[model samples]
Target: MSGKSSWPELVGVMATAAATQIGHDRPDVAVEVLPPGAPLTPDYNDHRVRVFINLSAVVIQTPVIG
Candidate 1:
């Protein structure tokens, strides 16, 4: 079976932990932590996971492989 492709549980988790978990789950993908309101490129990359966090460094958006 395939590994985790999405992280809904990490929504309220810390940004660092979320990133670490994503990295551990999908080692091939690059994990990028984005601050709230940050500009995101329209381009899509299968090898990337964007972790959107709030000012307190807490994940506000569910991280998912793109």
Candidate 2:
């Protein structure tokens, strides 16, 4: 799935988790492999080049404070 979301943080966190599950095991190495001080989160449309993981999003909203 090609995932994009209004919540880039959610995407980033999930991406980080996915990486960790697969043994990348470091947040920095998970998101971007280019160098230090790269973007803290991937773009909404960005799937990792090496891994070819497509993250097509399906958002369902619920009130957080309801």
In the range 3-46, model 1's lDDT, one tens digit per residue, is 78899999999998888888888998999999977999999888
Ten-residue stretch with the least lDDT total in model 1: 1-10
* Backbone clash total, candidate 2: 6
Which pairs clash inside model 2? Answer: 1-56, 2-55, 2-56, 3-55, 3-56, 3-57
lDDT of 2 at 50: 21
lDDT of 2 by residue, 1-66 (tens): 332212322333334443343333222222322222334343442333222223432112210100
Which candidate gets the maximum TM-score versus the true structure? 1
Each prediction's total of clashing residue pairs, residues at least 3 apart in sequence or on different chains, is 0, 6
- TM-scores for candidates 1 onward, in order: 0.91, 0.20
CA deviation > 4 Å runs, candidate 2? 1-13, 24-49, 53-66
> What lDDT does candidate 2 reach at residue 4?
26
